[model samples]
Target: MNRRLSFSLILAAALSACARQPQLDDPVARGQRDFQGLGCIKCHQIGGEGHAWGPDLTLVGFRKQPAWLDLWLKNPHAWNAKTIMPNFNLRDDTRADLVAYLSAQKGQAWTVYPWRTAQAKALPSVERGKLIFNMAGCVACHGQDGFGGYPNNNVVGGLIPSLTNVSDGYGRADLHAKIQYGQISSPADPSKPKPLIYMPKWGDQLKPDEIDAVGDYLFSLKPKPAPGSAAASDDF
Candidate 1:
């Protein structure tokens, strides 16, 4: 009877240990989660999973100083007026975690900027356009794959509008104007009054052809005739 009781107790303890939730005590894990939760992946890639809109951050730590990254992440506009990156308004703890995570990213090669090199072809390819869409920081505002509301406008206080199928919403000319010349007012409904947030112009950052390529990619994000046939969208 004693042996049976001891065996039963051991079994119960083993089961309890197996059922317990995994601890999230590790800072690196927390940082990675914060990186994703804060919508960093919308613009930057780690391990090639995220969009290419921003610099490939796999090895950013190796290139930039930690102090600089912290300051830049805090407020990019302070450094550059033409920067496309948005202020995340991160909590101290959250910012620390994100910094910890980003600082740890290393060992990956940087991706080449397509426009920096001479173009050998007359027309841009969709594949190249897709790459430019991310590298150009369009994903910073528009979600990965231009889905929009990445961190969710509600989560971010309605500062951003959705881009799920922006081509359908805005005409080519209107979209072109908004992309080339930043707009403070709502492109969807100009009569609705301007919001505090707005889209920045890419005139300074992007070459005309680069803008055209990114524009093509955005237009291609239009919903397919068969929803089931479309690729799964990234909620990150």
Candidate 2:
């Protein structure tokens, strides 16, 4: 019944939804129908209804790593046999299209997601936003000041970089997009083919406004003076 994977996935990846446009491949429909034929609908639900033996697939693409999805599809049993879901040894050709189909969906339209350009301006009040950070168990990981925290927690974990430094890394839009979706990978782990770790999708867990506030809070973490500067100007 142990469903853990044997040869570690050793997977790693980047982030993108292709701002140009998403192409609709005929293979996706094939994957969808096959998904139904395989009786995946019996235990798992996508946009349609199905028994709830598994977590809702409403936003799975944003939750899991793509490589993980590919591996999970090939052998869920290898990772967790106790899983009620059966393992389907699918062909690589077929699995590719199947993944494309499933990964290309947004749970529901008009959810006031973080990616919308118009809504980006409604950032939260920094005061209330600070406490939300603490309440959401964020301080536990990103640290009390959103600087950084333990990532692996297993063997020696990875170093989580400080949020205070992200503004220098990407744009406001890029930051929001990354936050809503998730990070891909970094220079530290380049050889692997899929994303290393994933951040849970908060598109649902957070209200649109809360998303804005957290966005504001994150966008605002500036560096403090080096230990001893009592008379610094707010603008300087």
Please give the lDDT score for candidate 1.
Answer: 0.64
Model 2 per-residue lDDT tens digits across residues 132-205: 45433345346667887534211123555678876678786776676666554453445443333446656555
- Identify the candidate with maximal lDDT: 1
Clashing pairs in 2: 3-79, 3-80, 3-81, 4-79, 12-194, 12-195, 13-194, 13-195, 124-213
Lowest lDDT 10-residue stretch of candidate 1:
150-159
What is candidate 1's lDDT per residue for 1-236, written digit by digit as tens? 69999999999999999677334576666888888777888987776678867766765554344665676778777754567899987777777777777777653333544444556234465556677665444565565777665321112344355665778778867776778887554334555533433455666556676666667767887877755444665455
- Alpha-carbon RMSD, candidate 2: 16.9
Candidate 2 at 37: error in angstroms? 0.6
TM-score of 1: 0.44
